[model samples]
Target chain A: MVNRCLITPARTLLTQTINPSLRNGFPAMTEARVLVLDADPLPRLDRLGARARVLHTDEKSLAERLPEADVLLVWDFTSDAVREAWPGPGGRPVWVHTASAGVDRLLFPELLESDAVLTNARGVFDQPIAEYVAGLVLAMAKDFRGSWELQRQHRWQHRETFKVHGSRAVVVGSGPIGRRIGLLLGAMGVRVDLVGRRERTGDPDFGRVHATGALPDLLPEASWVVCAAPLTPETHGMFDARAFALMRPEAHFINIGRGQHVVEDDVVEALQERRIAGAALDVFAQEPLQDSSRLWDAPNLMISPHMSGDTFGWRDDLAEQFLDNFDRWYAGEPLFNVVDKKLGYVPDH
Target chain B: MVNRCLITPARTLLTQTINPSLRNGFPAMTEARVLVLDADPLPRLDRLGARARVLHTDEKSLAERLPEADVLLVWDFTSDAVREAWPGPGGRPVWVHTASAGVDRLLFPELLESDAVLTNARGVFDQPIAEYVAGLVLAMAKDFRGSWELQRQHRWQHRETFKVHGSRAVVVGSGPIGRRIGLLLGAMGVRVDLVGRRERTGDPDFGRVHATGALPDLLPEASWVVCAAPLTPETHGMFDARAFALMRPEAHFINIGRGQHVVEDDVVEALQERRIAGAALDVFAQEPLQDSSRLWDAPNLMISPHMSGDTFGWRDDLAEQFLDNFDRWYAGEPLFNVVDKKLGYVPDH
Candidate 1:
């Protein structure tokens, strides 16, 4: 018999064994090994371990043991140890999966050049982001903060607020997050204009979707402008003083994308001048925004610690997604959500 | 020619006439008796005097001339004078339309009993209320106020947030405003449970609706419970201490309905106790909430000065609704949005 290997069907093994060569002619009783990196509780890996030989290690041990593994599941979202440590002396794992949507944290030149497949947690964040955008739009329109203040004082003041219907909105970025945001708003009767990288067909009820170049025209008409695009060279610092100036004096802005996409100083300036009505920001240019930043005092602005796409049970959704992908991989079927190293997505585009 | 009256339309009519009937019908007529509520510079109405009788009234003269008018278009919402002073002793005007919703300020028993027909601005407010609800949801979910404080201090903390999807919401009222709220949230993937007065078929999305009695069971499951119901004997103070106590600690309460529906002291107590997570109130038991009231200081509370449904150009939509009704009445067509006097709405039920 050919030295055939039958990888114990762990979630990770199932994901890696999708290659026809790996599945059909293997040493029949030999188990494939998987390395799970940087998981604290390691329940998901433990569950996989029941079916296969799973080795779990933190950053301290990963570099030493990575070469023996057939698959690697990168669970540590905060560290790029996988990129720096992967592609060992002989040959690397056939596949790698990240527990996050953005793999910029894990991208390495070597990983990009290698034939190893890459996948990410994609669909998990879409609805949450869309919901977050809706919430921001409502908070600004209804003056929720003001209401909370009144409740503290037992004061009831009747003030006029703006309505969403007949209002125009511009959702920047055409990714799943942005598209979902548009769908939610469009259903509310607000005329939504979705600005994507380029136009595509069969999109539902979008009032108008233009390229980034059309933002100048779209901005002036928008009562609410949402930023849900990714953080890329093209999107970094895309919202600045000029962008704010283009918006209506009554318009409100919301950012659920990467923080670096906005020029923080310009946002503060525009708000201080009362040029735009208000804004809700979930991401900042810097993490753990320094305590000394002046954005806190910017008038009409609502800030949230970046929590828009992070929700309860989110981890479970990511785990489930990985398991489904693993099943597809083991069956030699085309994998879903495979990331294109260059565009950084499976590129539904 | 039936009295042979000639009514000449004013040149400024294009700007002031929001009612389609007035725009299309009055302008084409060369001879019809017209009474313009001429106040101030009155040039717009003065031009009409050339071919028809124009009644110039200050605050004092309106009561005396009201009976002779064939129709009364209440453009001024500030005047409660019409409710108090209109002479219904003789045959009242054939029609009365207010350029506002909630005819509470204008409705009198005499007007109800007279041959005069009444219509109010209803549909104008539906979308605005819906938008307001969306804002409240977002503000609470995203911790917008907290974020704002952090932003003011230039502190960025990336925290996890509760998502609107897979969450349950209950909209207490089944009117256009409440239905619109349900629809908006539903679009965001929230499982919306609309509670109306009673169970009925053919209602929009009635599958999700429950009766008022089901509120106790629904409260515990709802992440958001919105109050858009009208104020009635049964509904007054419905959200009492017990109701608040029933809500989950993670739930948020929003009141866009009349303030009298909520027990202010009880709501404060609930928030203080953390029995329910938070609340956003736009309407209050008293208007211009007293500065000394303790509600302003309530923990996890959001207060808006009752401005949710009010928006720019909202008055125009209200005006158009009335004008459409006027045309229907003159043309012997059944009127739309006729008030149910007892129920305070046209009996869509």
Candidate 2:
């Protein structure tokens, strides 16, 4: 079945011929096996017709086929099957690409410590998530969600709403997503202070993203605190009770990053105790947020099913990003958006 | 009680003393009655104490005291008392200003034709409305409203949403509010074309605002179309069946303008027939949107009271704007935001 999916088109050959120096002693460019762990229809790779062999594996069969592929594409980004499947592998795929911004689920010890290279679909989600964050900030301030509820109830409630202009925001994560959020908010007249690894210089959008040490000080002044950081050991549960406690009672928190960055219980407690005004959490510690979670019952909290950046045509963007990298892999060129295995994220320059 | 409110301090004198050449034959500024049509707490004009006589009148007493005041401040902008009281046989205030952007309710023919100069709180509402329009655009594109509803229901349903970046938007009204909306949307990678009275030049915000005539051609191309125009005979009911027909089925309509700009029946029918995707209406022909209105039952319709521009400190802003103008008028200086009486709205330069 997998053999039938191979197609060797002229474009693949053209790429190999153009970069003969990269061909070296590498495996045949047109015969590389491409395994995709897919939950939905993957973007068509007919352009690589017979040049790259493709295979789709579900969670059940994912482990059995691990060693048979030259490259693996984690199309089902929300699944943990790759991590579960990697341990029993005879040999890992030389390259693994996840159709997601974060590689938390795919960052198991075996994969991180292995010789395999990791890349993620980064740029595709940057503006979409930024736009979503901007939307949440406006919606909450205008009490638009309340307006929607009133509309549903056929009530005309006129109330004074908050202002976005001149308001202060501390956006955690100085990556593309956070920077975009800061820029968008800043354009709307919000005073934005983006928190990253260290104080960044020469950044046109955000003047100087403050260092991590400043988060504690920044949190106290933020009316809108946003978390857009990548998940890693050092950053895991970074927004714990101490972070939540530092924020003003009127402040709102939003998490569009990996759910692991926040302590769910601390947030829930904050919401219950009215430590924070509200939150619009698109990511949670566990998604498809289980019915048993106390978050649903918490006051003034907005829960979304982890799709902040999952805009339409996103799958196609991810597929095209992977295809571009695949061509580079065939030519043995350096891949784009390569994650720092030691840092477990794309390290900022 | 009204006599006690007057206080004409020397800051009033500073202007009069400095602009002596301009204060020719004007009525005694110290004894001038400043009648404030107040609904909520009026702005403390204590600075003008004893110099300018002040009277606070509710809707019931407004007509009785209309002839006594030299200047009228329409602080209760929502009331129709000004229109109803204007036709009474009494002397009129020489200068009248409404603490609202649009003065539809106050634009009676007698007042329009009268020599009384009319002004509005134009700049105060501009950015607030622009911010609201941007919020609506992003909310609709990301289906953030649907997510809010799901959050309320405790449902974890993930859905495909649209991208805001690279999307097209046509913002009606090239005034401060519309230009601001165009600028904000453009900042987020949305291609924004602003429509105004005539193609405006030297507009730093919107490079060039398309003439209102171009709206017919521009409507079909927009993914999100925003209306922030003033209500006037030329603009009334412009978004009728023909306009709705011109829009794509996927396009979303948002009206932050006076409700009269849209024909309620046409939009409802369009939404009902699935001719248009959805609408987020903050204004209606009759607001506190009547329960009997079919718009309430219209699918995918988002309704909000006419509070789009009414932010937290908006009242203070409106009051301060009026007070600034009052000082100018006392000095016999040409009042700012003076409406072109013939046009029924502020005419663009």
Candidate 3:
């Protein structure tokens, strides 16, 4: 049955003549095995053709199957099974790719030190996530929640809402997603202060990209503070009590990066105490956030499932992106969106 | 007692020399009596100085005071008392300035037939209403109402949302308010078709402005259809059953122009039958929509109490705008935003 599912394409001759992997002692392209960490609604890998052997495994079987594959496709990106199964494997794949922008789940010490090249779906989520963040900013400013509640009561209460233009924003992270967010907000007439890992001056769009260290000064002045940084050791819990405390009472915070990037308790406290105007979290420390979580009922809070970048047909986008990278891998070409394992993200030049 | 509130400034000396109304059989600028139709939290007219006598009147007293005033300030722009009392007992004011963008209420036959020059609060609400409309567009596209419902239930249901960047919009009304809406939506990467009374091509921002007659063709292609046209005889009830039928099933409608621009029953029917995806109405066929209205229960409908343009400090912005025009009126120079009675709006050049 497995043999019938695999293709015997005419490209076998092409692989032998031009493929550089043969010179590196790697298996012939046709013999390369790809193990996809299976999740519900599996990826469409029909484009792989007969160039590679494909296998599927759940968390329970991943470790046992790791040694048999030349490449690992982390299709269930939300699972941390790879971190646990990496060490138990007899030998790891030469390449590991995740269907997500963040490489945090695969950032275990062993993987970071391994010879495997890690790649991510970095560009896929940038525009969609940026749009989601902008929507949250506008939602909070316009008090749509209040309007919705009033609509339910069939009341005609007229209230003045805030204006989005002329507002100030502090976008934490200089990546494509964060920069895109900055650009969208700037287009809406917002004054955007982009904060990255280090200070960068003379940016054509933002004029000056402030370093993470400048966040303290930027926080108090910003009406909208967004977190889109990678979940590195330096960024984990970056928006803790101290960071939330520095924000103005009327400031709003939006988190679309990773759950660990925020200390959930601090956000709940801020909302409970009305220290901040409001907060919107598309991610949580432990998601599916427990039903008993206090964040659920936090005042002036908006909680959405981790779907900021999941626009219609996004799965297809991810699958197509992976196929393009697969084509490059089959041709012995360097993969796009290769993450710097130490940084846990694809660093911008 | 009213004289105590009036300013007896040196401007009275300057008024006689430059005021052109004096030559037109109108009252001298300094002798002008201003009647303000009052509402709660009345306007600050301290800037009017000592040049004119300012009198405040409610609906009951408006008719009695109409003949005594040479200028009328429609401070309570929502009142229709002007329509009912216009032909009652006295001559109308030489000039009427409404603190609102829409002059639908002041467009009564008597006012339109009279020589009274009408001006509106045009530019004040342009940016704010545009932002409000943009927010509604984003809110609908992102399914924020769904998120809020899920959040209330503490459910984590991940769903794909629609993208806004590539969407199309049809913005009715080519006046400043409509143009501003088109520009802002255009900046957000939406393809906007600005519809006016006549077809206009080669517009710098919008290459072509479709005539109102083209709405049938445009509605089917638009994901967002906005109504910002003046509520003239030709425009009243324009968004009727036939118009709603032309819209795509996934298209959303937003009305911020005037309540009468839409036929309430048609909108309710469109939402009830699910003919349209959704709608947001800042202005309804009636203000302070009654608690018993059927529109309150319409599906996929968002209703606000006509506060789209009333952003924070908006009243102050209105007052300041009127004062600038009042300065022009006092100097006998042409006033900004002077309405064309025949068109029922400030005609664009």
DockQ (Cα-based) for each candidate: 0.53, 0.70, 0.73
* CA lDDT of each prediction against the hidden true structure: 0.71, 0.81, 0.84
Best by lDDT: 3
Per-residue lDDT for A164 in model 2?
92
Winning candidate number (TM-score): 3
Query: Which sequence of candidate numbers ranks them by DockQ, best first?
Result: 3, 2, 1
Which of the two, 1 or 3, has more lDDT?
Answer: 3
- Summarize candidate 3's per-residue lDDT along B1-349 as a digit string, tens digits: 0001112222332243335444554434355677899987788889888767789999999988887776789999989899877854236677788998889899888898876778888888888888888889888999999999999998999999988888999999998889899998888889999999999899998999999899888999999999999888889999989999999999999999888889988999999998999999888776789878888889999998898887899988888877887776666566677787778888774
For residue B125, give model 3's deviation from the true position in Å.
0.9
Sort all candidates by lDDT, best to worst. Answer: 3, 2, 1
Q: Where does model 2 exceed 4 Å of error?
A: A1-30, A87-90, B1-29, B87-90, B200-202
Tens digit of per-residue lDDT, candidate 2, span B162-241: 88889999988876777778888898789998987778677776677798898889999999988988887888999999
- Preferred candidate (TM-score higher): 1 or 2: 2
**lDDT by residue for model 3 over A160-235, one digit each (tens)?**
9888899999999898889999999988899999999889899988889999999889899999999999999999
Whose lDDT is higher: candidate 1's or candidate 2's? Answer: 2
What lDDT tens digits, residue by residue, belong to model 1 across residues B135-227?
778767867777665555566666667877778998998877888889888877788989987765566565756789999888889999999
TM-score for each model: 0.81, 0.91, 0.92
Best by DockQ: 3
